[model samples]
Target: MSSAQCNKSAITLKGSSEIVCEYLDFGINSILFQRGIYPPESFKTAENYGLTILMSQDKEIKEFLSVTLSQLKDWLTQKVVNKVALIITNVASLEVMERWDFNIEYDGDQSQGDKQVSDKPLKQIRNEIRDVLKQVASSVAYLPLLDCLCSFDIQIYTKDDVNLPQEWAETEAANIKNAQCVKMRSFSTNIHKVNTMVTYKNED
Candidate 1:
């Protein structure tokens, strides 16, 4: 199919679910015209729109877009049509805490001037929260059916000035980055909790 046609189809299929039957000609047209890439005329038919069109289908391009258009191509193959379903789950009601206990040592004038005090640094506190998040993710990663959960949408809710142990927060960030199919959303729950919804689109 021509680049314009493929782009049109892709846009049409955008935001559709796995089981939905829809035409994606609009998406295909948009991608081609927007990117200014033109495909040969030989591929410009309804049946071959998805197969014969190619325009910078590189991994770097896919990551840059953050939407995985190329990967969507594989999923659009004849055999995989309507065979996928995205599952969404919530991990709420989590409580985080920070400890104010630590040891600090300084040597200086005692009676005449200063005294030694013990406290944790802000960096250390952040690291602690990151560690906790890592622990939680580690556990979550090991579930027997986790592989089936291809995409993950993570939402972290907390209170204001809530000093989450640094480690846990960092770990959570890393997990979201490493997930094969995942999206992360963060919110402050003191005012209200937030919810997210996911929907998939298929190309015909």
Candidate 2:
């Protein structure tokens, strides 16, 4: 995980509509155009080869990924491009806790004066969030993208969980499978300032 504060200027540019034009002119190998607004510098290091775009609102990248799975169904019949790399910006960690309605409770004898706390381990909660996102990214979007492109290698670049739930580390290993598609991993970085480079692989 590469964590750093990004430049504000880059983030502003990324959110602007001009980002599409800017990236097109960037002449990079590939573009993981996260429709969500964030920093632009992160993509500066992408290989100058083929350019691919992924678009969705900043708040809805996960939802968009879920919906895109079915959209790429036809591409499966065409050439096999089995690998894809995902670049996400503005990952809302709190949303996970909100979705799961996770909370802590305390129950103990007041007279005895003992602390009996029951709380979802932060790590466990974070893992649940990671698993959910990973499932959505790999099983839903990346898999479909591979099926459409006719390849199988996929990689992801994302932000490191600050104050994350413990289960996050283990969850990542469970959601990915090696078959028509293999080797899915995620890189972590902070998108609050400058942009970073992410690598994605697909095999058929």
Candidate 3:
């Protein structure tokens, strides 16, 4: 019996939004560290969700992520965005090598107002997050090792009417070539459910 099948406790709308953003913060930092996007010394590990996770300490990166996640939280509560991706590309060739996609699903009637919580337990949600982070920590075992210079971009999908943030530019979806997609564990906040998947260039 998987933990995900357990009972879910209800939480308020605000709580659900916070959970999504928090997961994004941890997920981004973990992926950046695991995929070798930055120097190892730039990250420090902290205990979270019953796991030791590496988090970024760089000031500029920190600010960037905060702003992005803050904006994302609003959309999340409104059920505006559907998917977000952390894309890694080769610096010289401009080729996408890997993509970590987090798919957002929701089922709450926002018209009823923002005070409602999801029907899932908070503990159950955390366990699901832990499972994905564990997979990220062990990614090297299955993901191909990259030897080229790489850079990453955080791209999200939203409708055109979404008030565009000045810093965000519209770009085509960046996908990997000959990709192998691995489905990862997901958690939900009743109002918002997030599912994760990782795709990398199939070297085989």
Top-scoring candidate (lDDT): 3
RMSD to true structure for each model, in Å = 24.4, 19.3, 5.0
lDDT winner between candidates 2 and 3:
3
Candidate 1, residue 80: lDDT: 31
Candidate 3's error at 116, in angstroms?
Answer: 2.9
- Per residue, candidate 1 scores C-alpha lDDT tens digits across 25-128 of 22222233222333333123332222323333444433433343333333332113221121232224121110011111112222322122112232442343
Ranking by TM-score: 3, 1, 2
Q: Which ten residues in a row have the lowest lDDT in candidate 1?
A: 95-104
Better of 2 and 3 by TM-score: 3
lDDT of 1: 0.26
Clashing pairs in 3: 8-120, 8-121, 9-120, 9-121, 11-117, 12-117, 13-116
Q: Name the runs in model 2 displaced over 4 angstroms.
A: 1-54, 57-162, 165-170, 173-192, 202-204
Q: Could you tell me every candidate's TM-score relative to the true structure?
A: 0.18, 0.18, 0.90
Residue-level lDDT tens digits of model 3 in 1-204: 444543244577767888888988998899898888899999999889999889999999899899999898888776788999999999999999999999988866666666665667678888888887887788878899878889888998987789887888899999777989998877776688888999999988
- Candidate 1 TM-score over all chains jointly: 0.18
lDDT of 2 at 21: 21
Model 3: residues with Cα > 4 Å off, grouped in runs:
1-10, 108-113
